[model samples]
Target: MYTEKVIDHFLNPRNVGIIPDADGIGQYGDPSCGDFLRVYIKVKDGRLVDVKFLIQGCPAAIATSSIMTELAIGKTIDEALKITDDDILEAIGVLPEEKTHCSNLGAGALHLAIEDYLENRKDN
Candidate 1:
């Protein structure tokens, strides 16, 4: 069963889109598993000024990704990088045991995005 927060987020997912000029973009998930997610971020002054996501997944995946954006925005890159699957799971309340892996979707992609940003920064 899903929690109220989970259902709410799934039903009305937030930050569900793409950032064309994203400072960083990252993807996570295996095609064979059916859940794939892409996270885009805009960083300004070492902080995440904006965040968005696109996902091909179930309710849990959508909800997790939705809440992750809320958690990451306004956070410093260091702070955002610290976000974890457990953090998102906590913020969203609960996910079925079988769906728990979905918690990784957002945070994983987010970390990768930050890494991408750092990599791109180094090249410039």
Candidate 2:
């Protein structure tokens, strides 16, 4: 049975969309599970000014992506990078044991986007 918190998130997922001119973008998925996630971010002055997500997956995946974006926005890149899977799970209140991997996808995608942004900055 899904927890009340999970239900709330699933029903009203946050930050669900894409930033047209995102400074960074990252995508990841497992075809076997049909769980895919894409995260977009806009950074300014070394901070995550805005964040968005586009997810094509189950409720858990959608909720995780949404919550992750909400957590990342307004955070400095360093602070965002420090976000762990536990933080996401705790924010959402509850996730099925087996569905925990979905949270990883959200966190990994966000980290990847931040990494891409950092690397691109270095290159430029």
Candidate 3:
């Protein structure tokens, strides 16, 4: 079962697009599972000025990806990096135990995006 927040997010999916000039990009998916996620971030002055995501997955996956972007935007890089699966679960209000993977994927994808940002910054 999904919560109202989850359903709302699923239907209205936030930040569902791409950043053409993204400062950072991260992707995660399981070929066997058929769920793919890509998160794009625009950073400025060590803060995540914007965040967006493109997801091809289930309801939970879509909702989590949507929620993750909302949570990341306007956060400092360090603050966004600390976002966790539990935080998403709490925000969404509910997710069946079996679908917990969706939340984990959201958190992991965000972290990976941050990692990519930091790495890219290091190189530049």
| Candidate ordering by lDDT (highest first) | 1, 3, 2
Looking at model 3, residue 35 earns an lDDT score of 84
lDDT of each: 0.94, 0.87, 0.89
For model 1, what is the alpha-carbon lDDT of residue 93?
86
Over the stretch 13-83, how does candidate 2's per-residue lDDT look in tens digits? Answer: 88888899888998888656799888899999999998988888888888888888888989999999999
Instruction: Give the per-residue Cα lDDT of candidate 1 at 39.
Output: 96
Error of 3 at 14 (Å): 0.5
What's model 2's lDDT at 116?
85
User: What residue pairs clash in candidate 2, if any at all?
Assistant: none
TM-scores, all candidates, are: 0.97, 0.92, 0.95
lDDT of each residue in 1-124, candidate 3, tens digit only: 7788999999999888999999988888874777889889999998998899988899999998898888899999999999999998888877888888888778888889889989998998
Instruction: Kindly indicate the candidate among 1 and 3 with the higher TM-score.
Output: 1
Model 1 lDDT, residue 40, Cα: 97
In model 3, residue pairs whose N, Cα or C atoms come closer than 3 Å (at least 3 residues apart or on different chains), thus clashing, are none
Better of 2 and 3 by TM-score: 3
- By TM-score, the best candidate is 1
